[model samples]
Target: MAHERIEVDLPLAKVYELLCNPVHFTKFLERIDDVEKVNSQTFDYTTTIGGEEFQWTTNIIDNLRNTRFAWITINGNLNQTGTIRFTPLDSGKRTRVDFTLDYRTFFGEAEEDLAAFIEELPVQLKKDLQTFKDLAESDTFKDEESSSEKVASEVA
Candidate 1:
């Protein structure tokens, strides 16, 4: 298992909304090539590592709006589960994200190779979290949010 905590400049609702939608994951998650929504609570993700592509389907196990989100992979090449907790900070002006991931490596790998992968998991997780934080804080995200709100308001 690997855990990482990051504080994002966006509000809790904004952060939670982003986290709930896997379609936005490719923007921040390293190696993720695509995410396709299977349903409101399920998605298919494709990732490439070392010139090999892996695909997985994930089902949402928990989705407490503005609180926490959890998911488990199923019927895919990867076996993994993860949870992300959202905490509002600065009176809802900002958010703190606590992310935890547990995964099993592919079968048939050498013991030494598994050990090396495990050793680097935490560092990779930390970097991924930082990347997410950076994306949430970027002006592009803000502009996108504004545009979405604008479209919603116009539709209303």
Candidate 2:
């Protein structure tokens, strides 16, 4: 079993919400083009990489607040299961996100040759997380202010 972890500078709940929402992926994830929500706990996305596109569907296996969420790949060109864990850091000023993607060979057979793939997954994932962190810590993350706040600012 190979493991990788990344910590983005956002609250755990914020990170969890972003990861579960496929609709917001394009704002940071480069390989994912679009996502269609099937229901409250299921979704599908079209992911493109290296000029190749594949459709994948995932079911929400677990959902928790400020802790973790797990998912299993339902249908896709590959087979994998993943988990995202959240840990509070610096007394809520920061959060550590740990993501792990586990998989076997396409035929369910294991071999030593697979390390190459595993080694690169974390690098790619970390870069994506960093981008999200930058966006989250900036002033442009979707602010959910109420109409009264908006009106007051406009009046001012």
Candidate 3:
């Protein structure tokens, strides 16, 4: 089990919106290669871990708007469950994100390597969280989203 937290200079709703979008994972997470929606609440993804690529599918178990996002791996090399919670701070101007991951390490015939990977999981997760922070706070992300929404509204 690994737990991590980070505070970001963004509203809870904004952060929650990012988390709820599965496609955003491929964009923000360095290890993620692709994210394909399987259904409304499920996605299939390819990710690189320790220089090896793994294919996985996950189902979104809980999605409490602007508050929490949780998922469990349905098929993958490892069995995993994770949750991310968003809490508003500074009167809803800032958000505190808490992330938790619980997983069983499985690396085919490479048992020894799994130990090292497990030890590094926390650091990797923290880095991923920081990457998310940098992305959410970036002007390019905001501008792109805003313009896309504007175009969508115009088309509608």
**In candidate 1, how many clashes are counted?**
0
Clashing residue pairs in all predictions, respectively, total 0, 0, 0
Clashing residue pairs in candidate 3 (N, C-alpha, C atoms within 3 angstroms)? none
Q: Candidate 1 or 2, higher TM-score?
A: 1
TM-scores, all candidates, are 0.79, 0.69, 0.79
Q: Could you arrange the candidates by TM-score from highest to lowest?
A: 1, 3, 2
| Per-residue alpha-carbon lDDT of candidate 1 for residues 14-128, written as tens digits (9 for 90 to 100) | 8998777776766666646677788998988876555556688889999988999999998676566889999999999999999988766556552554455456777878998
Off by over 4 Å in 2: 1-4, 49-51, 102-119, 143-156
Residue-level lDDT of model 2, residues 1-156, one tens digit each, is: 334466666666676776665556566655456666788777776654444555677787988867887877788764556677888887776788777766534556434444444456666667767777777778354553323345568999
Candidate 3 residue-wise lDDT, 4-118, digit = tens: 9999998888888877877566555555567778899888877566677767788999999988999998898766677988999999999999989765645544455555666
Which candidate, 2 or 3, would have the higher TM-score against the true structure?
A: 3
Clashes of 3: 0
CA lDDT of each candidate? 0.76, 0.65, 0.76
